[model samples]
Target chain A: MIGVELRLMLRRRRVWLCWVLLCAIPALVAVLLAVTNLAPAPGQGGAFLSAVTSDGQLFPAAALALVLPVFLPITVALVSGDAVAGEASTGMLRYLLVRPVGRLRLLTAKLVSVGAFVLLAVVFVTITSYIVGVLLFGFGADAAVGGAGGITSLSGVVLTPLQLAGRTAATVGYLALCMLAIGAIGLFFSTLTDSPLAAALGVLAFVVVSAILLPLDAAAGIRFYLPTTHWLAWIDLFRDPILWRAVREGVFVQLGYIVVAFGAAWANFATKDVTS
Target chain B: MAGQRFSRRWLLVAAGAAAIVGVSAVQLPAAALDVDAEALRRCIRAEVPPYVGYAEASGRLGLPEIPQLESVTTLLTTTTRIRSYVAGADRWRADQLTGALGDSERDTYHLGAAEYVWDFGGNQLTRVLGQAPLRLPRAGDLLPPDLARRMLGLAPGDPVTAIPARRIAGRDAAGIRLVPTDPDTTVGRVDIWADPTTALPLRVEIAARTGPTLLVSELLEVTDGPPDPAVLRPVVPPGAGAVTASAADLSGALRDLRAPPAPARLAGRARLTLPSTPGSDLPGVGVYGTGLAGFVLIPTGRDVADRAVDGATAAGGTAIPVPFGRAARIGTPLLSVAVRSTGRRGSLLIGTVAADVLQQALLELPARGRPS
Candidate 1:
């Protein structure tokens, strides 16, 4: 069942298009940076994208940072939002239920497939960005020299290539897990409505609202509970002697959202009559 | 029908989010107003002594200190090699000390606008009227007296708080912390120690945002009486030729000595005031965010662009080639200089900001000032 669901997600042209869009963005950024040789001013674009001119090895990490806030989350929403809702809307839910498949088992398979798609999407962008960045700007030492020759790490020690690669991998893995909470939210919305469009919009609305309020000092207290608050916490992985406090909090927050949202989805789908 | 159910949940989420924001709004302003910069400034100002008695001091200005008997100049920091040794308010002397090998010294005397400079280094002495000469802070002023005055004179937006009292210069003093309100400022904070009796600053330290004490000036010892009157007089050796500089020549030479136009906003946080006119012997005064952070751009009259490039080459610092010209970091801490010149006239953009910020400001100024 998981294999069939995974194959279904892969065969979709829109899913493939999302991958293409993700890969093309980093290449475009690299080309633009190479041609212009001017970095974006502070607080512009991805946090570390400007660092690419000085060191290309930060490219993959920067690419993920650029897209994670919006593009990557939206892609996850599209697939996960359609998981159960698209089936119900098209009258396929009733047939699947008639084949002795428990609704619980069906949801589990669908979630596993969606999760697989999320992982694949992230890995594709990372590999493509690394290759394109290395070609445009030669990979140098992992020593993060800021501006002229200032050391930026908290410990003031540069990381080796293997250590940098390991940190980057850890960042990618953490970001993938972070998206699962959004996927769960989409899946919950998918169960609440039969229209896949409505489900996707629901997830997008939650994300957009969270982002809008993130900067406001008034929202600071309760910000820790919001999923958006933790999206960028993955940057801590690159820190020397990596800061685990925020990263750990982010994981627990996302895990809590996944549990509550997936539980709600299961509760609703188990009893809903598949009239479509 | 299903849309209606989801709409109800959406409204609930929105309300919860709004409630969180509402609660945060009520609490944050109270937290932010915790420090009052104005009160802190007044307290420090009240403590500065009106007079700093006979004092002797020695400290490192950056890494190198050229030790001298009567007075020591840390190579004067800038390329011009301008040095000043002042005893008190009415009597002070500044010398345009040049030559790499103790080659020459042009000593200038400042006495109530009657200016006399004996250029023994260039073999000429010049007299000028109505030209207010630039005055470097005298060693007497470098004590608790002048540094406290500058701290008190800072623009008002910086938050100032009173910390614990501590002993400085053998005197018990209260400490005041000044934090730049502008997020973009390179000054992390400034700590000033003021005499409990005189309310004058006894010690001042300027630190960068990245946590390093960049500049510190303190009096090692101070007496209760004035110095010998002879110490205040300027003595010129014989054989120096005398010349006269016209009023017009003085004005023209100092024309580019005006202050940099005020930036609308610095580092996007501090709003700036209109720049004041150039001071006699002083360059331009540019203040940001009510004086939390500011810099004086003193015209060097030399090609600052070339100087920056040369300095960078020697200092092992990278020279960022900009459209206007080149910018470079010449030294570290107390002696650090950011050179920005258009070759015609160059001004050293010196302040408490990090090296890169100085470079950015110099690079962006020319483009920002003129309209296409």
Candidate 2:
């Protein structure tokens, strides 16, 4: 069933569109910066993006930062929001329920498909940006900017290319899990309603509201538990020593979100009446 | 007989107790001396930094702030003279007295958010109405106790011992010295001379690991009289050309010849912190390292850096290879400056720190032409 769902997701033009959009941003930025004379302000952006104006090898990292804040999550939310709600709205869920496939198994397969889309979207962004950035900015020696691990680590050293690659993969994986947690929330909301658009908007609204509250000093104490709080923790991967405390905490928080969200989705679908 | 034997043992015990008491009595004065030393340390700690002295001077000398001094001071090892005059907090004037036959002195001034340069021989005073005024370095900052504490990287509980008193310019002063606690730090030691009465630092000497004093600032003369108010104002000669530096101006005229614009962790090892300065100097001075091993990156326009480098090379300075570009080691062991150019701008990496540390800074600092 998971394989079938994955095949269906891969066959969708919407999923491919999201990937194309994600990949285009980095390439566009790379080309624009190459032709233009725009320079990033002093001490702006992460170590990698800051390096983009100097070396093109960092363009992919810069592009990832640009998309991570909004685009990637939006793509994840759209895919997950449509999972159960889209089928139910089209009157297909009632027919699928008649088959031998259990409601819980169906929910799992939908989640896996959404999770696969999240992975594909992120990988597309990273790989596309890397190729475009290198083509435009010419690969140079690994220039470590600040501190041991560069931007995030307490150590003031730059990581080797192999180490950087490993950290980047880990960061991308963590980002994927974070997106999966968001997708699970969207799936849970999808079970609540038959409108796919409404489910997607519900997930986006939570993210937007959390982002708004995160900046208020008064909400600082409780803000740590918000789903959006650790969205940028992947930046620590760029640090030379790879600061683990925040990144580790981020992973745990995402896992907690996934557990609650997936559990709610399972309970809802199990008991939900499929009359549509 | 039993009673007599017991009485004798008691007597021996009383004798031992009395001996112990007598020894403690002899050590009482030593304990008192320790108390005095602690008091001295506390007083020195409170009075040494200019922050405290500034307050004391404000109360004692019926003045708004210390009068800005514009006087020519000769470098310790070289024939070059630097004329520095600071006014109205941020307004500054610095003139390099180049002893050339036909070349007049070059002066850089920052007046009311405007930075400009005056070439006496050329009869031109070019002003930068650029995005911001370039921050210039000051001589007074080198002698502050706060900077000394940071340079030495001292913890509150760090051991700071007293050096013998010295008579500096006729003022009797005691010196407090801090040695680097971290073995990895390149700094050897820092000595701050404080007036015993006022607790203000009279002189400061920073030394390297090899025991050569890297920099020293001492009062050559003393005067409590208020400075003439007339000299406090900068006088620009008539008919000098005025030039405005635009925001995008990357010309040698208005490069951000200041330190790093923001706090940066350099070469992924140490954080470069901006040293706190009074209103007189602009707030862009960057000092890297909390330990002995650190360098100061003074941003100068490419012209200034090139001139200095050329001047040093002409005087038989050695060229040192760096990752970005070649740097020059001007002067001997007594005084030297390593000049490196980056981002089309030039930075002078000045310190007694090891050459490798300077090289690391040169390799990692952002290129000078804007962010790109």
User: Which number leads on DockQ?
Assistant: 1
Candidate 2 segments whose C-alpha is farther than 4 A from its true place: A45-47, A143-156, B1-372
TM-score of 2: 0.45
DockQ values of all predictions:
0.01, 0.00
Worst 10 residues of 1 chain B by lDDT: B63-72
Candidate 1 C-alpha error for residue B128, in Å:
38
Q: Model 1: per-residue lDDT, tens digit, B149-240?
A: 67556635556777666665456666778776765456677787666544556667766666466556665344434434543344332222
TM-score of 1: 0.46
Docking class of 1: incorrect
Model 2 per-residue lDDT at A187? 93
Query: Candidate 1's error at A192, in angstroms?
Result: 1.0
Writing each residue's lDDT as its tens digit, candidate 2 over A125-160 gives: 878887787677764433433222222211222345
